[model samples]
Target: MKMADEGRRGEEDGGPGAVHQVFVVMESLLEKLKVLNYEEEILAKHNMKNLSRHYFVSSPFLAVNPGEQFFLFTVIAAWLINEAGRPFTAPQEHDEPNATVSNILSELRAFGVKVDFPPSKLKSGQESSPNYPAETTEEESVIEDDAELTLSKVEEEMIEEPDDEEENVMDLEALKLRTCPTDTEASSKPEEILEATVDAAEWSLEVERVLPQLKVTVRTDNKSYLDRLQEDVGKTLEKAKERYQQASGGVTERTRVLAEISEELEKVKQEMEEKGSSMSDGAPVVKIKQSLTKLKQEIIQMDVRIGVVEHTLLQAKLKEKSNMTRDMNATNLPEPATGPFA
Candidate 1:
């Protein structure tokens, strides 16, 4: 029973939470790519063995096979390295048909690699080799150590030796004040220390009494509560992202319509300028004038709609940010919680 409890405690402390940390980090990077609508491409590039599209994003980490997990992690690492303009490159021997900034990219292609964009480097002030490497002197270290040892010995001798009689003499009043406590006072000092001990012992006893209940709570209530909270938060974020995309699409559509209307309105105005005297009573001029007025109204309405959609999108993003922060704070407890199952 004791062994079982200890094992469970061990899992709770650094077991499941630690395993989940990697998944969390992966999700963050994939979420960025997903925002760009390139998640499938990343998966395809890695040529993941059995996992379906967005499996890494949709499913929990435990559902993934260990082999596939390793493959995906390597893929993510390669992508991030490329994204960040990593200085390291594949060894020269591993270069494929081409040897370029993209060489490191091909090295991971067997694993389902995606896009490989080599970043441009600064041309000016580039150097062939570093100018300085720190140098330490053995003689200097030896001298420093010798000096420290000599000082320590001098301090020790000063403390250990009795002072010359004249120097040793002290005022009687100062001596009385400086003297240590008597046996009764000393015994009371131990009691004073033991006062804290008594409190500590009581607290330890209470902890012992409560430990079983606490374990049950960790095994049941806390886990279930956190799981549900995480699920709801995840759902909310997915919905927010969807809504944001919808809002963006609406804005784009409205802008396109507005532009088309503006162009028509411009054409009509130009026609009026060109045919001003000749078309004063013409049917086409009258029609063009009416069309221009309608287009102006439509453009104004579209502009207002676009503005509202944009403001709503901004608020959605801010809300998502705040909710994500809250969820991370609430769910990402210290990674030391012990779990029964690792």
Candidate 2:
């Protein structure tokens, strides 16, 4: 968290250059210290803390480099891991074969280092001892009912086994339909478990060092951006209105044309019916049927046009809604009435 603290300070004070130098040095040190993952948490142990401090004082060779601060941090990280008696593969510039997490854990075990997840503090079951007490009868009934439902569902699925390869493919396709969290969610969980907070000073320094490469300037003038966003939203709103009107007109025209075609088809059918009745001929009936079929096809074509126009209008409405949301957010910002930039 020292890193995060330093970062925040750099932001508040505007002395980003100095903080960046410190962060780079610390990061370099961390890089040198092997086993920087969950194993780094072991540094709280007594042996590791002393060894870590000693290594920093003794390493005079890293005093003069452009990345000297980073170099120190790497050494510190290494000393902490060493003191904890955790096995860390000394960092190498080039990749090495046969180095794995299992291998390192085994090595640490040999050194008598305790390497495992921390003990959980979760309470026991419903019929609790010191923690949770027994549940009420109603609650117990609900739990039992839910358990039965779950068991039945599972049994049903198991009974319906994929006997054929085609069924197996279908099952796999169905499994893919469920939602899964992104990589961010997975990474965030570990930070919480480790109780890690980036020092503000270090964070600010790191951001300053890295942000320039990204070319994403922080929005300092809140009002200016709001004005720009509002202007953009207004334009989008206008465009959306125009598109909606055009779509409405197109749909109306198509609907009108379809109605006229339907009327014509009905009239043709009536004439054919009359001719057939007068002459006892089936030819007129067949001709009228064919004409009606052609008219139906024409109606279908007009319907497709109306459908396309409706889809376009829906998209325009969505765009208008998004623009309106942006406008609303802009209007909600307090006016910058008294400031140097204002």
RMSD of every candidate to native, in Å, equals: 55.6, 51.6
Candidate 1: list runs displaced more than 4 Å: 1-220, 277-342
Tens digits of per-residue lDDT, candidate 2, 88-205, equal: 5443222221122223323433433443321111011011110110011112223334455555665576668746445533343233222211254456774445566877754553
Per-residue lDDT tens digits for candidate 1, residues 243-304, read 99999999999999999999999999998887885766588878899999999999999999
What C-alpha lDDT, on a 0 to 100 scale, does residue 186 get in candidate 2?
51
Candidate 1 lDDT at 294 equals 99
